[model samples]
Target: MKVAADHRSGNSFLDFLLSFVADCSKFQSGYVALIGKPNVGKSTLLNGIIGQKLSIVTAKPQTTRHRILGICSGPNYQMILYDTPGVITKQMHKLDELMMKSVRSATINSDCLLLIADICHPPEQVLGTLDEGAVNLIKSKPTLLVLNKKDKVKQSEIQKKQEWYEKNSGMDEVIPVSAKFGLGIEEVKQWLVSKLPLGPAYYPRDIVSEHQERFFVSEIFREKIFQLYREEIPYCSQVNVVRYVEREAPAKDFIEIEILVEKESQKAILLGKEGKALKTLATAARLDIEDFVDRKCYLEIKVKVKEDWRKNEELLEHFGYSGKIASASL
Candidate 1:
């Protein structure tokens, strides 16, 4: 079965012919869920497949707290990729539980599942990463066991691991990939296109995501926090864009953001000596935001204390953990 080629490529004569053929033949579109344990390159794979960084990535695990939607559109197909938070066996806080719910919701909605795993480590049963709730959900759908980070492992090891998963893991297919280097991504995409049902495009071809601009702005700040800070500080922190004002011309766009921490000490640490650390983070975030938005803007940041915010159900629900997220407004 032929699938959509990379959408980012130029429109050559051959490409145009292929596009015409795809239009006349069949068009496939559907949602794909990226699921795996922490730091297993699920986000990386999504970004690579979408050919854009829709989800925030860091060396730290659990950097992605929300289910980020990345839309990839070719002439014939549109794949809506859900980059979800990593699955954890232990729920340390209400936030973790909410994140798990988000994962399960993504699984329910997806047409197919990509279960990513780090290839450097020994292969574990796919069932081990999923909870009881997800096992049935995954089994009912077409699931692919993706062994990511293949570049870090030997060719021999890759074969061994692939064999191990194909034999032991109860998945429809197994494919080794390096999400960071874009290896074997096309094969993965083709597999998804084969699994996706035939349908019309769910969104316009040009748009990459339905999320508002402010949502990405907030995520940029959150990603920077995870990168700049160490230990509990990043985990305890939550970044929100309280206010965003777009200006016409001479005036730059104004964005007022706030960071929530659990304690005064954590707030102080975020503030740093003479508030230097916060300033540094703001500068880094603003640069990325400017690049992402393709314009310049004035950024204002404030740090606040929200005691036990992670454990607060009402607050977590408000944060879009349990319901639809109007990211800009929230």
Candidate 2:
């Protein structure tokens, strides 16, 4: 069954399951992609709307490296939200460029584009901040300019910021919200629903995301690396789920996983003295994963250095981000 709710027949178990399906106002379903420069709270907004931290959030720039999916289903419709990487220019590493391309691709056919702008300043304050390719996206699309971190700013400052966007942006609308405070999220949901075209729900009510449990596990670990190390580790990291086996020991039904990085030196830093740091990350991730999935997970994380995998086109393509990049660069 695409969505578990479809099987509901008022059977005791099914009846309870049906009520758990998410619902919004009666409206058409669609996709929304959150886009912006690094550290602008796009991922935070996704988590707020879904009421789950499906997308990792950190203060560090470029915390999100690729498109992370989060799905929300309300009684009337389902909306898929893509929390994408920050758009920035970098010629040294091809993966950086490809990351921006993923953001562009996610924007296409998106019913609502959440253009996250930090509320502390006006868009002009970020002049020359947007790369050519990234700026081109805002120039053409119907986007919702979300002034994130609204709670951190004064009301007068927010209006000033909105006025700046009105003069500068060609997007459909601009709204202020604080992703951290979970403020204005429901309104954002309603606005996005109104924008989406009327159509059948693409996914079932029970499905929360398109990725497997293993993928979420990898993300949790990656998030820890990003959160704990920030600038030191994020730029040099990549988390791969090498093995994910489901355990059905009744008392210990769980999953096992491994996290892969890019350099031996980096691995050394991640593993830490007596392998203590890795152990800490795994322990924290295991609990969060268990809570998110509602099942026990025996997460095993090993740090391995692949040596400049991000810089190699072949490796990047294999990991699914280098769709247009050539093979020779590897």
Candidate 3:
């Protein structure tokens, strides 16, 4: 029994593939990278464009560690939207340095930059681009300044945000948007389409992302972990999807995922008394993945300790962090 990797055995395969690749083309559509400070709605913007919660969102800062590449496919185009980790403002650990490098690299690799700034933040707070002197780099790029959460503030106040942004950042093109409410998103789309050059598609038409199913499943679980433990355990943890099997005989699918923490204390924090927390996290994550895949997903979870993989270079590479496009490209 031979198998096919490129060819799908089911109907709608070719149509999906062609559509996926066709969407990535600039003659049709193109890619854009959203970069800005944490909690500024980058993930919200990506989800808003793709109309799905592909990237996890939370109120806590530094919620995103990896670059979420979400492809939005339309009739004649697609946008390979990348949601990167927010740029670190203060001096951070080695891991922080690598993540910030990834964000900066995304800024350069992208065709257009949508620098998000929350309208709800202080009027004097630095919004859009980071104030750490990376401002000029973004200013030189074909950029759009998105004032997200406009609905959270008064319309007149949002205009004040626009004026404040223009005076501070030299950003002439500031567009107010409410990502949660689906306002001003189409304008952002039109703005992005205008900036990208016409070219052949970069990916197949049917594909929504370059990552496989396991990556997304693990990410969805990670979101639950982050939401639950947050400063207690999230940044010090990672999700490893060990096994994913599609069963034709049983007409079912199962996934084995591992959650790694940095220490025994952290492990305790995750499991809780009689493993209640772990059970809760797994249940929520399992439901989310099941919905995403539209199947009954059997999830196996194990909690382990890796002791600071974030700072260890070899371990980071082993975990597939061989310079995510940010470090590799720039």
- Tell me each candidate's TM-score: 0.90, 0.82, 0.85
lDDT of 3: 0.78
Question: For model 2, how does the per-residue alpha-carbon lDDT over 1-330 read when each residue is reduced to its tens digit?
Answer: 335665554575565555445222344788888888788888899999998778877678887876877889887778898898886756458788788778878877477778888888646534255666656655565568788898997888888888888777666777889999998898888888777866668887787788776667767777777777644577787776666666665655445454556767778888889988788877777777778767776765556667777788768876667433121211
Best by lDDT: 1
**Winner by TM-score:** 1
Residues 196-256, candidate 1: write the lDDT tens digits.
Answer: 8887788888989888888899899999999999899999998888889999867889999
Cα deviation at 86, candidate 2, in Å, is: 0.6
**Which of the predicted structures, 2 or 3, would earn the higher TM-score when compared with the native?**
3
**Ranked candidates (TM-score, high to low):** 1, 3, 2
Tens digits of per-residue lDDT, candidate 3, 1-330, equal 123643555555666666656644436555687987888899999999887778888778888877789888766566788899986767446678767777877777787788888788886445434654466667677888898999888888988878888777666488999998899999988888777766656777677788777878878898898788857587888788888888764476878877778899999999999999999998999888989988887787788888876788666655655553211100
Worst 10 residues of 3 by lDDT: 321-330
Stretches off by above 4 angstroms in model 1 are: 1-25, 326-330
Model 1: pairs clashing at backbone N, Cα or C within 3 Å:
none
Clashes of each: 0, 6, 9
218: Cα error in model 2, Å:
0.2
- RMSD (CA, Å), candidate 1 to true, equals 6.8
For model 1, state the Cα shift of residue 29 in Å: 1.1
Q: Residue 38 in model 2: shift from native, Å?
A: 0.4
Native-to-model Cα distance after best TM-score fit, residue 185 in candidate 2, in Å: 1.3
